[model samples]
Target: MSNIIQRIEAFSQLGQFLSQFTTERISKKEQVLHNDLFFDAFKMQVERAQEFNGWFTLDNVLFSCEGWSKSLTNENLNKFIDSINIKKNTPKTIAIIMAGNIPLVGFHDFLSVLLMGNSVVVKQSSNDKHLLPILAKYLEYIEPSLKGQITFTEEKLENFDAVIATGSNNTARYFDYYFGKYPSIIRKNRNSIAILTGNETDDELNGLADDIFRYFGLGCRSVSKLFIPKGYNFDKLFNAVFKYKDIINNAKYANNYDYNKAVYLMSLFDLLENGFLMLKEDTSYASPIASLFYEYYDDSNSLKEKINSDKEKIQCVVGNGFIDNEIAFGQTQLPTLLDFADGVNTLEFLNNL
Candidate 1:
């Protein structure tokens, strides 16, 4: 096999490593799987990654695809790949300061750096301290030699050829000031948004539920804001999300819902004509419940312009006939090995650099 193909194969095996501790059959460390909040993170990815060989295969296949390996639209890939192909001897180390908003958000950068033949030094998030090591450990079990290349550290960020960091808007400024001197892809505060027309059906809305509720709506990829058409009825939207009412059952989430609800009611009793916890209303991308997010819009074009003006603050757009429950956002635990951060084409960036 070609050397490039061989490298892809080696890295793709990480899926197997991560899948070993199936998200379903939680390792002994997990005291609870499903609870008052929702299915625990990695609750879905591990089972699906392990059982669905088709998806696992697709994950690996897509990793090797030009769209991923080249990390650019087809037009951009050709130019980038040609340049990289000519610079085989250039050595690089990519220091990734990963976000822990959703589980395994860091993995995407990890895979990209590895596939491109750049060594990685990762500084993990404090909140989400699990999974990466489990993945790294399993990968090493299968291929002992790779143990050296993948590592998790609390190390200070110094002496790296390049850097990629994902964090809050406040932190981004700091990251920029500290790390901007070098080649970097430092991301700031950004949230995904959904645009809605009144015509959406039950299935479409449920799909949107995953986008907003997954990772308890904490990640940048989560729907921090939403855009809906004028006079959109909450009845229809709530009806769509009702299946996930169980999200309230999770203890942490339930606490958030209750706490926020009480605060809203006490602060503005008359303004809150709607009930406790989540009220039906027009508002913004931030949600009312502990594990929810929302935003409402009256004019689609106006909101589009608003979003366009602030594109850096927004991530993916979800809505209307396009939403599908099958397509998860921030597939927290088992991120597609190829998904790049900040929608920036890392390989293309490297090639151009």
Candidate 2:
């Protein structure tokens, strides 16, 4: 019991350490010098969080880890070191296919590999390759230990023990076929949701927009759907979001919104066809197109039935207004220090291997 207490303490300290990494390693001004991919990703994260003035809060960072670690057991912790597989000594490589959305989507995968005690071979997302390394300077301050383990590459993957790839439903098939034989985890298209009690004031409703639109609706963990009590009028919801119109006012978002809205309207008349879609709502948690943030539903009696029915499609649910065991979208995966793949808890798996 005392050992468990100490282990928990270590995680708490590690959480604090990592929180500082987000704030200290990342900079707003120096962000301009990053690759364009990271520049836009960071901008979206900062601006949407309304922390544009503050960058990332150490509090949020620690909160994310705490949220993720809720399910870890003392038994799991005891076996963590045994579950991870790493080649001993120099140049042992692990391949990772990173997510493009959100700031430092790659960082999740990078952190997994680092914590698992392996060298990383990263396939930087072409869409987001521009901005993630802004932390190279900050990481230098926090952990000189990482300086040796990190390596970037565009080269063909070769000579690696494990591969971790994240992509859409389509790309996942290819990942399964090509990377299947090797030890791997291939992530498919996942959508997140939020359960609403409809008790929120205008202020909380508006804040919900941050969970929905923080990364321009690109993150897998962002609220992708909403479930609400019956007969909830959208007027109140729209009023809340309308307050954040300044964000929609941004040229890029406005253009995308207009483009998606046009496609949606056109689709109503069967006038246009292509890679476009628009979803309607009284108060949805989902955005349309390449990403979904949130959605709303009125069915109460059948709520759990509906969710369980679509369980295969739904990846995570952010149940607001719930107590005790309520978990959010980002918290779906119980990540340990070594759950290096698609949020799988690898330490437990490799320990037996």
Q: Name the candidate that leads on lDDT.
A: 1
Compared with the true structure, all predictions reach lDDT values of 0.55, 0.52
Residue ranges of candidate 1 with Cα displaced over 4 Å: 1-3, 17-89, 141-147, 269-284, 288-298, 321-339
TM-score of each: 0.72, 0.64
Looking at candidate 2, what is the lDDT of residue 257?
Answer: 68
Question: Tens-digit lDDT track for model 2 on 201-223?
Answer: 66567656556655555666656
Off by over 4 Å in 2: 1-92, 133-148, 269-286, 289-301, 321-343, 349-353
Give the alpha carbon lDDT tens digit for every residue of 1-353 in model 1.
12444445444443322332432343323332222222343335433432433213223222222222233233333333344453464647779998765545666677667656666788988654454565455445544555576657897876678888888778989998988788888888766777667777676677776666655566666665556555667676666656566656556666777777767668773332222226434444445445334456665567667767776666666654443322243232222323455668777655444
- lDDT score, candidate 2: 0.52
